[model samples]
Target: MLLHFISDLIRNPELQRQFSRDPEDTMRRAGLSEPQREALHKGQLEPVMKHLRAELASLELFAVVWVKAVVQVGSTQPGIAAPGSTLALQVLGDFFTTGAFAVVKLEGADLPAVTRSVENPGQRGSVLSCTLDVPANTPMGVYDVVVVNPDGHYGVLPKAFRVE
Candidate 1:
């Protein structure tokens, strides 16, 4: 089925904004869609893998949640990040007043999730940016951006790209 993100986001700013607001608001908004949220729904490896494949940015080894639904990742490449490098994550979606989703974090080996401008939101800069400091000993492999909130709300958006 064809899903128009912009339309859906515009029609339901609150729905989208919730993803970018504080942890409570994010969880509250996520609760509204728990029945259909992919991140929250329990699934198998293949299904979850497939979902991550489609919900991740090949350009980036990872991605970060934007206003509420968008993710601006880097260009995809093999071994793009050298040891002791900083990974950048970005997103652009509906604005969230409480600021870019509370308690936003990334997961990976020897990596630190760093989020700036939390107290002072990105101001809907047509996009949002975050960073995950990769340890000097970070291993090389595929990864997923798992966004979660305090109220048990979470979702993983599509982030795929083509090399050819």
Candidate 2:
């Protein structure tokens, strides 16, 4: 619907900021684009709202952005573990594209895998987020929270806190 509008605008190209948050691309995708998201940090809602408006006007299938950040353990600093946090995945897209969700894995002794089914945070959708729980005896080593999409476009998110 609205996406059809953005498709009409894709001809301009500058509007298409990024596809953003492809679970399958996580393996090949590199580090986070911006570790400290100034937008959220500063609580600047303009850019987000601006994009949302553009997406709505575009009239795409779904006006939302989906994000899945598979945070790595032990990256924030030494002796710091995210015991309690509302882990969020940042997504950005217009009417042309909707967010993606697929498989999520917490690799460890048992290879616990889960299919993260989240709502797209597009202009008309809700943002994706999760809470991480560090295992009591979580080895105190490097662990990975890998996120993948069905189409195979993902990014190995930045490492999380360390257990110390």
* Best-performing candidate as measured by lDDT: 1
Per-model CA lDDT versus the true structure: 0.38, 0.33
Q: Could you estimate the TM-score for every candidate?
A: 0.33, 0.28
lDDT of 2 by residue, 95-145 (tens): 111234312233543222222333442222322333344445555544443
In angstroms, the error of model 2 at 71 is 13
Candidate 2 segments whose C-alpha is farther than 4 A from its true place:
1-127
Model 1, residue pairs in steric clash: 20-101, 55-157, 55-158, 55-159, 56-159, 57-159, 59-76, 72-90
Instruction: Kindly give the stretch of ten consecutive residues in candidate 2 with the minimal lDDT sum.
Output: 70-79
In candidate 1, what are the lDDT values of residues 1-164, reduced to their tens digit? 00223235457767566545553445444343332344324434554455445544443323233333432232222213455666554443323223333222224342334444332232233233457556665665544443333333434433321111
TM-score of model 1 vs. true structure? 0.33
